[model samples]
Target: MGGYLPETIVTNDDFTKMVDTSDAWIIERTGIRQRHKVAPGQRTSDLAVEAARVALAAAGRTPEDVDMVIVATTTPDMPFPSTASIVQQKLGTRPCAAFDVQAVCSGFVYALTVADGFVARGIARCVLVIGAEAMSQLLDYTDRGTCILFGDGAGAVVLEPVEGEGTSADRGILGFDLQCDGSKMDLLYVDGGVFEDSNRIGKIRMQGNQVFKHAVHKISEAAENAVIKSNLSMADVDWFIPHQANQRILNGVADKLGLDRDKVISTVAMHANTSAASIPLAWYIGVQDGRVKPGDLVLIEALGGGLTWGAAAIRL
Candidate 1:
């Protein structure tokens, strides 16, 4: 796993200067101290390429060796050619199956789930899975409740098929569950889309209290289903990596599962909520710090814009 955070630092103190918020008020509510932002003219692909290069190198594989590239991002460079294509070209990889998956924040897991299907069926050999987001670009800086909770960053992981006897002991994705409840879309979303507005771009609008009301129950249930599908119990999970939406949400899910709080990997304090990038970014931190190791049973989960939520079990 690999991760990248832009150079520009936007701290809670910075928000006080631009919005009707203070450092103490922000920290007391979200547990976020600071976040990174991309420079002007730096596209989403730039972050994706940076993270992908490092991940490919760490995995000891060349771009030419990859069979597919799946980028999970809500903020793509364009609506036409997927950012995955740009990432493939910049990495000097051959023309292969490349595309994007946008389940909002649940994207990385969705992309990983899709890639695992291809590898399991012998459709691809090595796949590059990336969750890159410039969520700051989508926020209304004046909206402290939303703007203060996002940052710009990217994370990538290289997944290859590992033969197994069809058990929870498998090395790759053992099991996964994907779901969406569009009825609750108003809880969190952007105000515009391709056809909704002539501007074609819009700032994010979130009903914090409403979203919070629904998150814990759906997220906890998804986690439980994934673990049971993998034929394992919560006690068997060595690590808990939840989408870095909020510290409160992370703790809520852990408590629901009766899992140790220390077992959870979190980067929300420094990275804030990088949306789809949060899970992989948190996982990369664990890998680097020696908390996450090979053969560890890991539980991954997220809740995103579509009111989409999912979970997957992996033996990494």
Candidate 2:
């Protein structure tokens, strides 16, 4: 369900030395125990490869059988070669179309939508979609407000075509809704980029309160949109695999939607906001732990930088 975190754990104390923050402060605001950071020299592609391999094995498929690779990462190894292409080569996949999707935290769902379209159109048999991030690379470790909110990790899923009556009961993707508002881009974004900074990525800047306010509303709306698109009522959802941002945000969204708290799968306490990697990682963990099962109706929702948000309804 999820890729392994590096053995080393970085505590808030470790960050206290690097940033102006304390463990008590971080714990009080965000329920993060610790987070995993890739060693220097590790790249997003590396994480994607491992996650993709695990997902492929989980789905009982070989690399050669995969017909597509979609990587969702704002942090890529390089700008020249797409991370998905790098993953494709690493997995030894042949004759497959590979690319990247960038929707910040919602990138996984966006990438999944692309893969779903390919499968539905009979263009691909099996697609490997990965959400990998090295947010540590983009973090301003000295900034207390944002530095403690991010971590590095990756998660993946294997999508395969299935024949069924065209209905919500089909054992695959049923519905999805994606949205973006550039006017709110300043709510959470990096300050510098290509044209201005010699193509070097910049440090992340976030208005925590502003982002928090919109996230709760938009995520709930996306969740409801997905459920309604599937022609299902909220009561029919078996689980909600929400983006693991903060416990408060998750709880707020669940409460707003009147969703059962027990049905929400969360990994924020352990993952510490892995951006695009959150939902897939949570889904993987839930399924691997027997919390999610075949025939379960799973709803996923996410919001992040770029003010992008989306949701997907899938019948497991």
Candidate 3:
């Protein structure tokens, strides 16, 4: 029915001793004042379960009502036990298909798109989709540029079947587009991975300038494409929820799309970039603060490490 984000959080200043960057510098570049990091012993599934509980409660449904669990994250607790399965077990849901979707930061949107199709195609009645991350484990605190840009958090949404007249005014997902550029993989990626690197965790590495450039350009195009696919004009969009990466990237996309600054929903100023968790977290905050409401046309877009980018147009 809607979205949910954790209330607990941590500020950038809290990381001052853990890294070399200052709060002023982080805020100036990323617009992030704080973020929610999982406790040392906290697992990704723990965050997912909490968020799923809130979302299911909001939808007024029990776990048994859910037909699928889709978790979007790059930082799964283990390489073997899918985070979705762990969430399924924790929620005590009836047997249901469960899996994880990995597309880096654009993961949530990608997962949401998949869930939307599942419902629309009559494969599922109710779906619980979660975007959870524990990026703190991947951070190389010594690298200020990358270290300062990420945090840990989770957000979830409940998507139920809704029939529409097959038009842009449809209440559920109206339009969606997903794209990937393998050529840009080197721009933002970890140095190692389980399958290829002997199961060793990799250090986060990024070329901020290049990623920023492509992010602004691709995100703008993806947003426009989604709008067009929905058969609606940009002016019809009431809220633009872009990926919470850098403040500059958000600004550039907003400017290029000709959307009013105020029309953009920004939690990055506080949440930093939770990667997959960013959009849903922003959506949850917007709803909680009364910025998002029923009947509003929302445009969601994201760009991340597979060089993956995606967009969705939804009428709430």
Candidate 3 on 186-279: residue-level lDDT in tens? 9999988766678667889999988988888898888899889999999999999888998888889999999999999998877788899889
Residue-by-residue lDDT tens digits, candidate 1, 135-176 = 988989888789999999999999997778878887989888
Residue pairs in collision within model 2: 1-284
TM-score of each: 0.98, 0.97, 0.96
Instruction: Tell me the lDDT of candidate 3.
Output: 0.88
Worst 10 residues of 1 by lDDT: 192-201
State the TM-score for model 3: 0.96
Off by over 4 Å in 1: none
- List the candidates ranked by lDDT, beginning with the highest: 1, 2, 3
lDDT (0-100) at residue 257 of candidate 1?
Answer: 92
| lDDT winner between candidates 1 and 2 | 1
| Residue 216 CA displacement from its true place in model 2, Å | 0.6
- Per-candidate Cα lDDT values, in order, are 0.92, 0.89, 0.88
Give the winner by TM-score: 2 or 3: 2
